[model samples]
Target: MFPADFAYVRARTLDEALDLLDEAHAADQEAKLIAGGQSLLPMMKLRLAAPQVLIDIADLPELRRGGWMSSVVGGSFGGSIGALSTYRQLGRDALLNGGVIRGRNENVAPHRAEGVPAITDVLTVLADPQVRARGTIGGAVAHGDPASDLPAVLLALNAVLTIASRKGRHPESHLGPYTPRRTRKEPLNIGKREIALDDFLQGIYTTDLADDEIITHIRISHQGGTASAYEKFPHPASHLPLAGVAVVLTYKGGRLTDSNGHVTDLADGSLASAAIAVTGISPRPYRARAAEALLKDAFPTQETLAAAAAQVTTESPGSANRVSLLGDQHASADYRAHLAEVLTRRALAKAIARGGRSL
Candidate 1:
């Protein structure tokens, strides 16, 4: 199964890639950007996508860097992940693994009680080692694959994506209605737009990315007294999740106590907030707002947790619109919904436990 004939352009830099994409658009030619090629290549091979141009940006150094930052945008301190970062890199990142926070004022990094467990957990199960090694987080999210694990994790984390485009380079400088001027030597006048992870994903294989835009970074905040975990039931053959849930819990005053009820970790005892996101059960991953609202400031007892988990469907109370559950040969809609609840319970329990409590 060979792909259709296309012109392959290996871009040396981000600007070059953007230029090529712009040219393709101006000419009305179908073009696709290639990073890790883990997602796009397979679709091309199957003849599902046959773009006339394949622009490779894998070698662009700017997209490969990943690190912690004091502020990614609007004075929010968190981790800034380069779009080209692979699952292998994310899985091994110390900053994401847990409690180490890099302070903006000083070079010294402080250790915390917990790191981001949900990300590492998802990375471990997101396919075999080979696929994980080559799959870029940006590519997976940009492709808008509902079955992919990372999008749901991002949703639970309340992550933000930085989308870049060459919008301001033209001499008109109107920032409104302007045409791009072609100049090989002129540096790219890059503009950025930040979108919430939940808003960025529209539906199956769809995103908010414009034709000339590319995802530049993913930003996730690390708050004190918060922990996250991911759980999934994956298909045996493809390893894509049949139902996956990512839970992030923020507890304000809960002390890590011993079996005798003695405070072990020296903390408070109040649940502040909870966020749950589920994937692989619908056309797109979505935040379980009803479930989250139920758990907010509520003790995560077995009964309450079960009640919250039951609200995993998009049809939960206060939902804006109804979303149909996706059914396939592998799993029926009823069963998939059931798995969503089960996995949500498991994920919430694990996340709460990581916050030093058990239900």
Candidate 2:
């Protein structure tokens, strides 16, 4: 399948890309930003998307740089991953793979008990080496594929996205909490807006991104003692998840110590917070708030985990309403619902185990 004829424009810098997008907007011409082209190229070849102009920004340094970034506060760790960071880059990142994070005060670096298992697990099974090498994290998010693995993990982790656009034009509004990081100076500057990943993804192949805007970074914060993991059932041929679940859990309470000062297994603790997100079963990946409500303040027992898993597809916090799920020849609605429940249970168990008895 040959793609429709389109003009290709390679952007020299981030600003140059924004300017090109702005020009396209003014002329009412369709323009799409291309990075790894792992997502767009396929759609273009199938004639699913036929934009008039394609702006290449794969070589922009600002979009390619990423690593452990300082958190907004002390005694915690967070990351500001460049949107264009590929799956391979993320898989090898030390901080994200359970390495010790050195704070500004070098003497008191915090050790992450469990690195973000959700991300690492996704990278391991996302696709073949070829796709993982060329697919950009930002592109995957921006593309908003409903069955994609990473977005569900981001939703569970409560990740934030930094969006950029030309000055004088504000990012879209009424999409959850908005955090703006820019000055009001009257110069030709860039406008940066931060939005929760939950609100950013609206539906299948749809997002809150404006035509003139580009995703700059995906930021995540991990507090001490928090744990997370992802579990999925992928289709045999494509390796895309048939049903995927990501769980992030936080616990409150201290470990028990015996008279000899040895830690015991009798520590009393309760869940402080729980974020459960599921994908591949619905029109869009969604947070399993009903399941979260069930786990909040509860002990992480096998029974409790099972009870919460049963509600992964439930719509309300305390009701029997189920979400409208997607069904196809690959998996029926009933089968997907079943997979969501089973995978959610496994994900919660894995995350709890990662936290150990201390959690």
- Best candidate, TM-score-wise? 2
Q: Which candidate is the best by lDDT?
A: 2
Model 1 compared with the native: what TM-score? 0.85
Per-residue lDDT of model 2, residues 18-92, tens digit only: 989999889899999998998899899999999999999898776775556444343246768999899998887
Per-model CA lDDT versus the true structure: 0.81, 0.83
Candidate 2 TM-score versus the reference? 0.88
Give the Å shift of residue 49 in candidate 1. Answer: 0.8
Q: What is the C-alpha RMSD of each candidate to the true structure, in Å?
A: 6.5, 4.2
* Model 2 pairs whose backbones collide: none
Candidate 1 displacement at residue 164 in angstroms: 1.2
Worst 10 residues of 2 by lDDT: 179-188
